[model samples]
Target: MTIKAVVFDFGGVLIDWSPEYVYRQLIPDEAERRWFLTHVCAMDWVVRQDGGQPIAEGTAELIAKFPEHEVLIRAFYERWQEMIGGVLDEGAATVEKLDAAGVPLFGLTNWSAETFPYAWETFPILRRFKDIVVSGRVKLVKPDPAIFHEMASRIEPHLPGIEPHEIVFIDDNRKNADAAAALGWHGVHHTSAAATEARLRELGLPV
Candidate 1:
């Protein structure tokens, strides 16, 4: 089927988000920083925050588990904005191009509901999306079919019975791309703006 809308993943794909960016400022020691992130402020713990867990509650839980790293653990949420390096210009330009071409744009991101305000406030380009399904808001993260289905379902209210197959989903992770592909959506495992633009052109988009 022909593509109708373009769905984008936020972190790593559209914007540069990494816990290390925040931790590097707090913990100056390289090896110690890696260990703290790996063991204390692990991705597993942060993903829970992405799935709607309160940052305060999550930080408390981590601090309880590792009392010695209290300051560092709190910094994870206290300085969450520092984690995002800023929007990736190359990738964001594709989004802008698609928007200018009158293509429907949407975002499907795994981000903390508590911290998303920082991004929402920081980046003006993000406002261009017609709609966005944040995993934190819905308590559902991708690679799960539920999140994909939820996003697809939401689109119907706007587009009136648009099928999942009509959306082109772009993500940096292969598994997330594969999951959307399984649902009959066109999935682009994005590496760079040039490659994504090429794919869009192949799909006959005006971009």
Candidate 2:
């Protein structure tokens, strides 16, 4: 298969982000943190923000529903930066190798519009992408074919006449990777940095 450029999914693929990072400090008790994440600040609710819901609105809605855990709910977004540990070591290293090899890298991420700026500001790796299509800014989250198409559109300008099959997409989420595959884009499920690098090499990419 002829490949044009490789697209990367941000959070799990490159950045080490999780609510657990901050919650471990705030909640203290593992069991209670688990319950709170499961019952209150569920991933679905968090994902809504990723798809463009205002942070204030999301936090307020959750706070209203679970007034008993108001402090915990508020801390979800208020301390959003704390949830990020840093760039994944292997992933960052892999990106650097790819960059040096002149691979065309691009980003497609399900990140909140409000919070994505901080990452963009801090991580030089993210700046390596020729362009990035952020879910929150466009109101289109992944696993939805529309967002993948949006990525394709953004990529067209840099690598003209590129077809879906010519692009390789790497994502940590199997579902999102599968979605890209369904659209005829080659999908690499990023389980580990080593695995992702190997997969890209198999695809004839520089990495």
Candidate 3:
């Protein structure tokens, strides 16, 4: 089947998000900042929150391990909006084109349930999506086939009888893109808005 829909990954693709965005100001020294984020508030540890653990609970767990960094740990979730710079204009424009072309657009993102609302409020472009599957809400993260399947199944309500292979998935992570391809979906390893839009165009998408 020809690609009939586009599935997007939020951070790094459509919107910019990074612990560094928050930590840089808090922990001025680059080395200490990297150490704090890696050893204390690791992405692996943070992903548990993305997998549905409450942000407060996740922070407490980290605080237990690194009590000295309690305030920094708290800031991870408390000021997460600082991590999001804004929407990527290139990606946003592509989405707008796809939306205007009447293509079904959906989102699959590994965002904290507690913090995702901030993104929803901060970025108006996200509202264009027909549906969004948040990892925190669903307890599933990308590079896991289950989340991809979940997105596929959920989108059925809007685009009935749609096949996974007929959807084009775009993500900044190569592993996530690989996982989507494993399911026979056309995967676009997004690097920049221009490159991603080119890939979408190559896939015969409206963008």
Top-scoring candidate (TM-score): 2
RMSD of each: 1.4, 0.9, 1.2
lDDT of 3 by residue, 44-107 (tens): 9988989999877887888998898889999988888788889888889889999999998999
Clashing pairs in 1: none
Comparing candidate 1 with candidate 2, which one achieves the higher lDDT? 2
Candidate 1 residue-wise lDDT at 179: 95
Q: Candidate 3: misplaced stretches above 4 Å?
A: none
Q: What is the Cα-based lDDT of residue 13 in candidate 2?
A: 78
TM-score-superior candidate, 2 or 3: 2
The candidate 1 region of ten consecutive residues with least summed lDDT is: 156-165
Clash statistics: count for each candidate: 0, 0, 0
Residues 41-141 of candidate 1: C-alpha lDDT, one tens digit per residue: 99889889999998888989988999988988888878877788999999888888899888889899988888888889999989999888999999998
Can you list the residue pairs that collide in candidate 3?
A: none
Q: Estimate the lDDT of model 3.
A: 0.89
